[model samples]
Every structure is written in structure tokens, then in C-alpha cells.
Target: MAKTAKKIGSSAERLLKVTEALCAEHGLESVSMRDIAKAAGVSPSVIYHHYESRIDLLMAVFRQRFGMLLALRAPLVAELEAQAVPDVDKFLYSIMAPIAFMRSKGEDGAMASRFIARALMSSLPEIKAEVDAGIRGMRETVDIAQRAFPHLSREEICWRLHFTFGVEHMTHWDNERLEIMSDGLCNARSVEESITRAVAFAKAAFLAP
Candidate 1:
């Protein structure tokens, strides 16, 4: 029985991996269960056995990736909360570091990052609601941000955080646009540098008058 359960779990994980890659390479809306099955070397029926529908599978993928990110950020966030006063830079870095770590993971990591980006723009209402709910649950970090900038209205803080998300999303593209714009003087590829610059940028934005 344990072996059977293990086999089932492995098959589901393989389908998720194949689906993530396909969704990242193509767009989430373009990838079908048949595509996933073909890529995973399984049949459509097999996918159905594991997932009720394409949306269900996509949600599973989102949950898996988002859960990983939250797990990585939890300790960082806790440490910040333990501080007498939250450092703005450290507060932002706690949020950004997990994402940077994921992006540094090579092909699989890149695929996860792209899929996450795509998920954020997913048109399906269910997917959007799930993503929104997950983001809402991470309000602890936002609370830290609120403490770091008591002068900023909660609404303004949220807007700046939204912009911060945009910056973080752009980094996943790895296009080196910054390098081109700066005539190769600026590189956006270093994870530490990216996080530092993003933290500084966000700090300024948060503290803007």
C-alpha cells in the first residue's frame, strides 16, 4: 500500500513538473492537459486520474511554488519581527530573498519563476482569487512594512509594495535590459545586487514625501 501511494505521488509530481515547464515555455492558457500528458509520457486519462481539470492542475502548481516561497521567507520574516525596530532594507530583503534564491536555481527554478509570473496574470477567476488570498495571508510582512514607515498611510504602503512586486517580476525575465540601457555598465543578473538595489529603491519609494 505504501509503495502504491508512493507511485501515485511520484506520477502526480512528474505531471506537475511537465505542466510547469510547458506553461512557462508557452503561456498558461495555451497549455492543455493533453500537452501535459504528452510531455509527461502519460495519457490524458492518467492526468485526469490525478487532476480533475486543467485549472485544478494549475492551482496545484501555483500552490506548490507559492508554498515553497513562503516557507523560505518565514524564518526571515520571523527574525525581522523579533527586532526592536524593523529595518526597512531588511524588511524588504526578507520578502525578496526567497524569490531571488528560487531564480538562482537554474532551469527548474527559472521555469517555476516564469510559471509564477504567468499565474499572476492568469485570467481565470478561480486562479486569481487563490493568488489573491495567498497574498493576503502574507500580510505579516506588510505589517512589518507598516511599522517601518509609520508616516506612510496603509494605502500608500500598499501601492509601493505593489510597485515592488512589479520590480521583482521584471527580474525573472533575465533579459539584461538594464545592461543594454547602461551600455553594459549595469548588470541585473547578480542576485545579491538585485535584492540590494530593489530594497533601496523600495525604501526610497516607501519613504517618499
Candidate 2:
């Protein structure tokens, strides 16, 4: 019984991994069950045995990956909630640091980071909701920020958050566009430097009239 259960768990994990890779490469709409089975070294029936459909498998991947993302940011949120005086700089730093670190890693980190970037920026209504629902840390950050600056209206906080996401996407995702526009003076490869500048910029925007 134990061995059978172990095998089941392992296969399920492998299936998810294969699905993630395929989706990362070809995207969710283009990937099929056969594609996943071919990559996982399993039959289509095996995939069905574990997941009801492609959507189910994708949901599993989002839930697992985004759950890890939230866990990574949870300590920051906890520290903020515990503070007698909420510090916006610290809150912004806490949120930006882990994500910047994730971008610094090699291929696996790049893939996960891109996955999250796409999810957050996706225009598709269903995909947007799925991504938003899983990122509890993002919602928490907004609440914490509101408490820290109660004078600001919710609209003001949300507008600032829009710019914050833009900063994170550009800094963390690393593209040549920024460098090109700046005549190679602006480099985004330094995680610590990126977070430092990002927090400062966001702090200014939040405090701006």
C-alpha cells in the first residue's frame, strides 16, 4: 500500500513538472495532453487519472507555484503587521527583495519569474483572476500600505501600486530596452541595486501629491 501510494504521489508530481515546462515553453493554449504525456513519459490515461483536464492541471501548477511565492513573501508581511509604526520603505523592500532574488537565479528562476510576470500582466479575464486569487501577498501589501498611510485614499494607493508593479516588472524581468534607451548606462543585473532604487522610486510616488 505504501509503495503504491508513493508511486502515485511521485507520478502526480512529475506530471505537474512536465505540464509546467510545456506551458512555459509553448503556452497553455497550445499545449495538449499528448504533449504533456510525451514529456512526462506517461500515457494520456495516466494524466487523466491524476487530473480531470488540462485546466485542472494548469490550476494545480498555478496553485503550487504561486503558493510558494506567497510563502516567500509571508515573513515580510508578518514583520510589517507586527510593527507599531508601519514603514512603507521596509514594506516595499520586503516585497521587492525576494522577487529580485528570484530573477537572479538561473533558468529555473527565470522560468518561474516569467510565469508570474505573464500571469500578473495577462489581459485575459480568467487567467488574470486565477493569478490574482493566488497572490495573497499582493493583497496583503495593499492593506498594509493603506494602514501605513491612512491619509491617502484607496485610489491613490492603487495608482501607486500600478507604478510599483511596473517598476518590479521592468527591474526584475531584465530587458535590453532600458539599457538601450539609457545608452547602456542603466543596467538591471544587480538585484540589490535594483531593489534599492525601486523602493526609493515607489516611496516617492506614494508620497507624491
Candidate 3:
């Protein structure tokens, strides 16, 4: 019984690692059960024993990424809730700390961002809810800014709030694009620098009118 239990646990872990590896390499569409099992050094039967279908495995990858993303940014939430960076601009970037964490890392960043983009395009309702809720938090940040500076109209505040998230989300590719655009002339700069420039530019754009 002990040996059997240990084997089962190990198989589960290997299955998970294999799914993650496939996602890292080719995103969801390219990964199949046979491919995952082969890369994991297990049989397709083993994957089936653990998961119902490829969709199940796909959902698992989405869940795992979503959980890690939340875990990465949880500290930032605590800091802001504790009022660490009260300035709206810093606060804006601070909210996207998880993406910055990904950018600071290498393949981990690429995998995370691509997985997120794919998940965004996925039709799974639960995953959609998670993504939507995560995005909706940007509105809360705008509300915070409004509380801090109450002179702006509600529409102005809401639009600026949504714009901040758009800026941050779009900047996820800044490093990837910089590499291509600069032809290796410019190295990957700091996420902070990007955040600073984005937030400053956004503030100018929003507050100017």
C-alpha cells in the first residue's frame, strides 16, 4: 500500500510537470496528451489515469498559472492595502507587480505572459471570470485615485483607470519588442523604468485635458 501510494503521488507530479513543460514550449493548442506524456517520460495511459481529457489538463494549466500569478502579486496587494505607495502612478505599476516579476525572470516571464494571452483567448467561462475579475481590479485603483484627488469627473476617473491597465498590460511585450526593434543595440531595461515612463506618460495624457 505504501509503495502504491508513493507511485501514485509521483505520477501526479510528473503529469503536472509535463503539462507545464508543454505549455512553456508551444502554448495550449500545440500540446496534446501524447506529447505531454512523452515529454514527461510517462505513457499516455498515465496521463489519462490522472486527467479526463486534454481539456482537463488545459484547465489545470490555466488554474496553476492563475494561482501563481495571484501568489506573486499578493504581497503587492498587502503593501497597497497597508498604504505603501500612495502615489497613483507608483500605485498603478505596483498593482501589476506580478507581471513585473515575470519580466524580471526569463523563460518564466515568457511562459507566463503567453499562457495568460492564450487563456484570455480561451472560452472557458471560469478562466474568463478569473481574468475579468483580475482586470476589474484596475477600476478599484481608479477609485482610490479618485478618493485621493476628488476634483475629476467620474467618467474621467474611470477612463483613466482603465487606461492605466491598458498601458501596463500592453507593456508586457516591451522587452520582447525592444529586442526585435533595437537589433540587440538596447538590452532589456528595468520593468520599473517602463512602469515609470508609462505611468508618467499616462498621467500627462489623462490630466492634460
Candidate whose lDDT is highest: 1
lDDT of 1 at 16: 92
Give a tens-digit lDDT track for model 3, residues 1-209. Answer: 99999998888766776677676557666778888878888788888887888888777777777788778777665565566335655566565556777766787666666677667765666657767886676566666666645678878877776776677666665566776888976554567666666767777755666
TM-score of each: 0.92, 0.85, 0.75
Error of 3 at 180 (Å): 2.6
Overall local distance difference test of candidate 3:
0.69
* All candidates: CA RMSD (Å): 1.7, 2.5, 3.3
lDDT of 1 by residue, 84-155 (tens): 779878888886778888888997887888888788888888889998898898677678878888887888
Clashes of each: 0, 0, 0
Report the Cα lDDT for residue 122, model 3. Answer: 57
Ranking by lDDT: 1, 2, 3
C-alpha lDDT of all candidate models, in order = 0.83, 0.78, 0.69
All candidates in order of TM-score, best leading: 1, 2, 3
lDDT of 1 at 47: 95
Candidate 2 versus the native: TM-score? Answer: 0.85
